[model samples]
Target: MFQPWLATLLIWIPTLVTAGDPAETPWISLKPENHNGKHIVFVTGDEEYRSEEGMPQLAKILSKHHGFHCTVLFSIDAENGCIDPGVLDNIPGLKALDDADLLVLFTRFRNLPDEQMKHIADFVESGKPVIGLRTSTHAFDIPNDRKYHRWSFRNDQWKDGFGRQIMGETWIAHHGGHGWQSTSGIIPADMKQHPIVRGINDGEIWDPSDVYTVRLPLPDGCIPVVMGRVLSGMNPEDGPCEPEERDGKTFDKNNPIMPLAWVRELKGSSGKTQRVFSTTMGASQAFTREGSRRLLVQACYWCLGMEEKIDGKGNVSIVGKFKPTSFGFNSHTKNVRPKDLLD
Candidate 1:
């Protein structure tokens, strides 16, 4: 009864399941040498700003240099099982959040299915620390009929949804000139001592990404740590944006800079307070600068309540080869799977 064709069919079954199924897409894992005992799960899916590239490198830095176990999940192209930010609905491996100490979210306008989305919802309810990067403010674009519709960025029923309720703000506007104007991080005089900015100095952190507008005086209990000075050009040394006249009023873009990074203590459904850190700066190109990388690493420490370990001059070096693609729509590297990033 051992037919030759049956053996061939059995051999192909495993390959078919592995290659055709997006839900079985592999996630990148980085084990810590020093072992800090904390696990950080980075969920990256954005059509622009290359969150897929940036988050993996951040995970490496945290894992190799800082002693934390890191897992990076990507949106998978269901057709070929490759990483595709445009594939907004299928970000597998979110169940890793169940045991994660911190969740680094950098998605934009995703509408994941209920089962996958439930993991994120449950994580939030557990009152765990969350680090939200650029575009994360408008992370979900779920339909009203869905169970997780309240997580949508513009859900009126939930009053601006996840971004507003958890991170303290939703997408407002591009405060700075997109692409043309860049951002220079400025630690406020009073906030210089904050643990999140302990290793970063005023004007040291510069990101090619422009500043995003936030409704200010930010929501209650939220503290702005770093202010963003809109620059005239996309260089770190560029001068501040010039004043413009609008409706008989002169508007100075940097006279009152926007908050580049902020922190909040949010009460979760579990009635436990969770640390939330939100930053409008995390473009792939931004991590090329040491100051920008340091800011994020420091923020991770602060989020974990390990502020005592943050050194102003600590290591936040790039773990491996990283030449990030510039930010643009449909700009992600095609056909690349998560396993391809390990090299």
Candidate 2:
């Protein structure tokens, strides 16, 4: 089904400029000459985690390795036009989704303007593929007056909004200790044969970020792909710890631990079932490990309906020198632009 608008998008083939603006938002784009004709648009924003850095690294691998054209949109401080994740209001260049085949979202508590958010809503309504990571489960934190307030992590209209209704889970409590504990990916017995975990080893999938507490049985027909094992330390060799008993309840860490990565089918407003891939394991430091990188790469292929191209050996080698900053509040590199990330 060739959409008329999609045909026009192919003609432009790039992120268009916003002229006459003094402090225009900076965007990063990579369109390979030998392209796969598919565009993956990454939306990065968050105060705590370094999603700004993680988005670019994922985009580079998808563009440079898999031959897919990728565009990364960052949260910019409009006053100076520099990347600023703490500025939760503005995220320009979402119009790039007009041509995007997939939307890889990594935002947290974003309350974008109607003009900007319409692009994402339109994309979701169009039934396109979507991939979200980490804080994306609670991506939007809109006010009650706004039209897209229903898209927030907690909402009465849609009941837990996009994350629960569409992506799987909303902002839930952390299963492990916030900064003290680490997590290692443990492939579920049922998910071992799944393509997303095909090339990934159980112990290989580890991250410094703790495991998120999701509902035992995920909503919206989600299949649990990887479970996070709360580690005693940050190292991959760290020993697994049992879920602690807090107050009257016990946080289940080892005995049927919480899910770290999974997939969902979002039944959108367009009456289309959109393919959605989400994970809680995409912190910048997590990408340093080969297993974590391969898990995400495989999910991309699966989301785009190109599972046959997975190759199984998990050839997800890092594209270049990747040294991501540790996740924290206002932890992003200051006074930087999108294009400057490559240099």
Candidate 3:
């Protein structure tokens, strides 16, 4: 039997209940707004693992503030502290690859059923834009399956999993002390003029709580967007203990301490091209302020080819904490500031 939420979502179909709007109850908001022709979908629900945060709020922000037509899909079952709210089973009015402009995914150590996975595969095959956060790369789990292996960076089913191959890294432990650190001396000079990076500068940083360092190479055509110097004395989530002697050391001895955030154009086997923007870090509360927020908003606009529209509006700025609350969401106030890419 289908769960009540799943059934309700399905019944509502193309008509979705706006999270906070009573008037738009049980109906998807399809009204023509600034994002009239744009469609963005957010897949969230990994709460059972580390923390259930970010994804849902990201969708809401894009929808309400940026005027993006957004849909958020949660997992059906909550397993191992990971929530798999079973959204795929409902289907609602959702169809595969129906003019979707972007697919934003954030899942943990959970595998989607074959049918659900197929829907995602079909969507990606459509050659649209994709943005993944944190555990999204290795979000699934299915050993002894070639299809699942391809999504992982490391062969060990217990280790690298799917995230490494797609987003370029699995979740390694944080090197910097808990909380956030301001990034310095890492912004790409060449990309300084790029609108997506406009207003971002040295010493400006987003507080994504903890950032992951990629241990593998990204797909071809990937461009580095930001790089950071990793502080030393960090341990993998389930790896060996932190070195007692390395407590104050600010650099990793086993690996290069430089971490990167990037964008890429991927060409799949089907000859379709997809645009992707990945960052090792961008979920911290600090990111919702100053240059970091501006960079993210610009990146979204650029990905949607709406940079021109945003540019005509002058500078763009957003303020708030990007961190998710107990309800797994956050909010931001947008303010257009001047574009100063070189800054």
**Candidates' lDDT values, in order?**
0.87, 0.82, 0.50
Worst 10 residues of 1 by lDDT: 12-21
Between 1 and 3, whose lDDT is larger? Answer: 1
List, residue by residue over 165-255, the lDDT tens digit for candidate 3: 4455666665454443322324767767666666667545444344454554555666777765433322111221133355676534224
By lDDT, the best candidate is 1
Please give the lDDT score for candidate 1. 0.87
Candidate 3 ranges with C-alpha deviation above 4 Å: 1-32, 48-53, 77-98, 145-149, 156-164, 171-173, 177-185, 216-219, 229-257, 282-287, 309-323, 326-343
Candidate 1 deviant stretches above 4 angstroms:
1-25
TM-score of 1: 0.92
Question: For model 1, how does the per-residue alpha-carbon lDDT over 269-309 read when each residue is reduced to its tens digit?
Answer: 78888999999988899999888999989889988999998
Per-residue lDDT tens digits for candidate 2, residues 229-266, read 89988788989876677798996567777888888776
Clashing pairs in 2: none
Higher-lDDT candidate of 2 and 3? 2
